[model samples]
Target: MRLTPFRAFDWNLRSCGLHGHVTYRPDEEPLAERLHTSTPVGEAWRCLRCGTFALGAPAAAGPADEAPLVLRGRALRDAVILRLLAAERGIRGLLLLLLAYGIYRFDGSRQALRKTLDDYLPLLKPAAMKAGVDLEHAGPVRLIEHALTLKHSTLLLVSAGVLAYGILQLTEAVGLWLMKRWGEYVAVVGTSIFVPLEVYELVEGFTWLKVGALVVNLAAVVYLVWSKRLFGIRGGHAAFEAERHAESLLAVEHAAALA
Candidate 1:
């Protein structure tokens, strides 16, 4: 929409007594001129003097064909988080979709699936025996056997569940990438649902990976609730809007002038 510049990094101009003013190096003048003129309307660029990053320029214009404007933040942290989460969700969705396809294929040709597993068994047996594992009673072996014995209806149910999960993950991925508020709410709820299970797993057995997962989930929940002000934290939705407004270039310019 607006495509205005955003200050992505803090600069202590007060220390240099320059306020918001900056002086670029002689060598940087040519590059600055190019950046000033040729930077795409919605592209990000850095301040020539302080090297701080900003998205769009003061006079940047949005194409009539562009989508509605996103209220990007002055700080880059939240943008980074949103992008990372989008990537994570997209990967998870893809994996789930692959797993669902595999399950469907296995159910469609049980004989072929069994034959494939049998063929691989010889190669796997030696390794298992060397590791002192009994293949007959191993969890993986039993799970495979159970899968083979599943009725068509059960297989269908399993495939449906996996497909649904994949769809949910993909939906969240796209929404978060767009920085939608609904996406944040969905992510917060989805992650919160697993917190108890993750905690129980940690209580059952302690491992660095488990602890790390728990910590990461908890951190995401806290960050969304506190930083994004979900469900009325701080001054609630009004405060959220006000904060975004305050981060705009005009607001920054006004503050600099007053300072």
Candidate 2:
């Protein structure tokens, strides 16, 4: 009777021991020594050093208490999507804010420019009145002049902030779109840091729009940190280890079968 090449060869099992080599069947002598031998077949083929599978596909060996390995993949994908959406939202918000500022600063049409000045005049009045500015002559032209005189430093500071924020948001959007882990972290940390400040603004102003913005931002923070799974202190490391372990197991099994 003719035997298959694998059966006639007494294929050496690839060693998963700390020292990388192959172990032949003859080497499986003393029980203690056999335990270290890499020739075990079927479900029992495990690395002596890591207790990982030495043949076939690696068995799922994640923490017993944790969810199945399949779930981790879904969770990671969901987290990544949520992070990307959050980044997009931030970029949109920044763009809108910049657009509003641009309309106020450089709208060329006279009527539109005047309307922009008029809309903000009410907010400026209280400050101007406190400084004893006469409003009778405060038309668009004089009003703009007075605004520049009273709030030049404030406008400069706010403009600088908007520019910086726009750049940061754009960067964050690009990072998240690329599905980078660091981008996930940055989105969670940066957005969460602003929650308290937004809350403070809501408390001070108590406007419906302000309240809504605060609520939306807070919800975004919660989703990214908890549901996305990227913000977990150990999730990234655990996922990386699982990938490496799977690869190593596959390599060993392939080598053993070839041998």
In lDDT terms, which candidate is top?
Answer: 1
| Residue 250 in model 1: lDDT | 36
Per-residue lDDT tens digits of candidate 2, residues 1-259? 9868655421122222223332222222342233233444643333322333345433333222221222122443464566557566566757857765763474334456557667877777788889898554655568565554445456656666767666666666766776566766776776777788888887877889988877776776676565445634346557655654564444333334433
Instruction: Give the alpha-carbon lDDT of every model.
Output: 0.67, 0.53
How close is each model in CA RMSD to the real structure? 10.6, 16.1
lDDT comparing candidate 1 with the true structure? 0.67
TM-scores for every candidate against the unseen true structure: 0.66, 0.44
Best by TM-score: 1
**CA lDDT, candidate 1, residue 189:** 84
In the predicted model 2, the residue pairs found to clash are none
What are the runs in model 2 whose C-alpha is more than 4 Å off?
1-80, 83-87, 90-97, 100-149, 227-236, 239-259
